[model samples]
Target: MKRLLLERALYPLLGLAVIVVAWQLYTQLYAVSRIVLPSPSDIALASVRHFALLLAQTWPTLGATVLGFVIALVLGIPLAVCVANSRVLNLTLYPILVATQSVPKVAIAPIVLVWFGFGMESKLAIAFLVAFFPIVVDTATGLRSTPPGLLELARSLRASPWQVFSKVQMPAALPFVFSGAKVAITLAVIGAVIGEFVGSVDGLGNLLLAANSQLESPLAWAALIWLSALGIVLFAAVALVERLVVPWGHSGR
Candidate 1:
C-alpha cells in the first residue's frame, strides 16, 4: 500500500517540487521583475495574504464549472446514445455537432453573454458549449465500438434492445464515457474562465484580471495557481468516480 501510494502520488509531487524549485532559483538568479515572473514564494505569500478573497471568488467559478459539466453529461450522453443507436439520428445530428464544435467558443461567449446577460447563466452557457463536444463524440464512439460478438450474442439470446444496451454496450463504453468526462470537466473550467474574462463581476478569472490591471503580479500569479489547483481537484474527482464505476479499466494501471 505504501509503495502504491508512492508510485501514484509521490512522483508527481516530486516533479512539481523540482519545477517550483527551478522556477524560484531562476527568478532569484536573474533578478526577474515581479511583473514579469513572480517566484513561487512570492505567489505563496500573495495567496496567504488574499486567502479570504481567493476562497470567496473560487465558489463562483467552481459552481459554474460543476453545473456546466453536469449539464453537459446530462444532455450529451442521451444525444450520444441516440446517435450511436440510430442511423437516422447519426446522419442528421452528427454533422451539426461537428459544425458547432468547429466554431470558436471565445467568439460565441459574448453573444451568449448578450443572451443570458452578465451573470451565472452566461458562464454556464459558455462552459456547456465547450464541454459538450467531447462527451458526445467519445460516448458515441464507445457505444459503437462495443464488441460485435457480445452484441450478437445478446441478440441471439433474444434480448430486448434496452437490455442489450444496458448490459453489454454500456459496460463496454464505461471507460470511454469516463475519458470524455475527464476531458469535459477540465474544459469546463477553461470555459468558465473564458466567460469570466469576457464579462463577469466575480470569479478567480475576474480577480486575476483585476490584479493584472492593478499591477499586482503576485496576486495574479496566485489566482492562476488557484485555478490550476481547482482544475486538478476536479480532474481527480472525476478520476475517483471512474475508479469506482469502472474498476476494471484501471486494473492494468
Candidate 2:
C-alpha cells in the first residue's frame, strides 16, 4: 500500500515538475511577455502573495457547496426512497427528472439567479440543481436493485416496512449513495463557478473572470488551479467517508 501510494504521488509530482521546467524554459527562451504567459514560478509567487485573500473569498464558495450538497442529500435520499417504494411516482417522476437533465444547466443559471438573487442562496440553488439528479438516480437504483432473495427473506420473516427499509434496503443503498455524492462534489464546484459567473461578484469563478478581464493570465491560472484542488479535495473527502462507511462494498471488485 505504501509503495503504491508513493508511486502514485511520485508520478504526478514528476509530471508537474517537468511541466514547470518546460514552462520556465519556454518563457525565457521565447522571451514571452509575463502578461501573455506567466511562468510556473509566477503562479507560485502569486499564490503566496494572495493566499490570504484567496482563502477568505474561497470560504463563501465552499460554504455554498457544502450547503447545497447537504440539501441535495437530505432531500434526495427521501425522494429516492419514495420513488423506489411507489411505482406510480417512479414512472411519472423518472421521465421528468430525465427531461430536466436534458436542459443545459448553464442556460438556466440566469433564471435561477433572478429567482434566488445574487446571494449565497442562488449559488446553493445552482449547486443543488447540478447535483440533485445523480443522487436521486443512484439512490433510487440502489434501493430498487436490492437482491430478490434478501427481500423475499425479509418478507417471509414478516418484517415491518420500516424494519425492512432500514435494516436491508438502506445498507444496500449506501455505496451507491456515496457514488452519487462523489459525482455531486465535482458538480457542486462547477455549479458554484457557474453561479459566480452569472450572478455573484465573489468566489474563485468571479476572481478568475476578473483576472481574465484585466489580462492577468497568471492569476487566472492560479485561480483555476485552486478550483481544481478544491474539487479534488471534496471528491477525496467523499471517498474517505465511503472507505470508512462501506469498506466491504468493493472488496471483490
C-alpha lDDT values of all predictions: 0.95, 0.90
| Alpha-carbon RMSD to native, per candidate | 1.4, 1.5
lDDT of 1 by residue, 1-253 (tens): 8899779898998999999999999999999999999999999999999999999999999999999999999999999999999999999999999999889999999999999988888888999988999999999999999999998999999999889999999999999999999999999999999999999999999999999999999999999999999999999999999999999988575
Candidate 2, residues 35-128, lDDT tens digits: the string is: 8888888888888888986787788888888788889999999999999999899999999999999999999999999999988888899999
lDDT for 236 (candidate 1): 98
Q: Global lDDT for candidate 2?
A: 0.90
Look at candidate 2 and tell me the lDDT of residue 89: 99
Q: TM-score of predicted model 1?
A: 0.96
* Candidate closest to the true structure, highest TM-score: 1
Q: Which ten residues in a row have the lowest lDDT in candidate 2?
A: 244-253
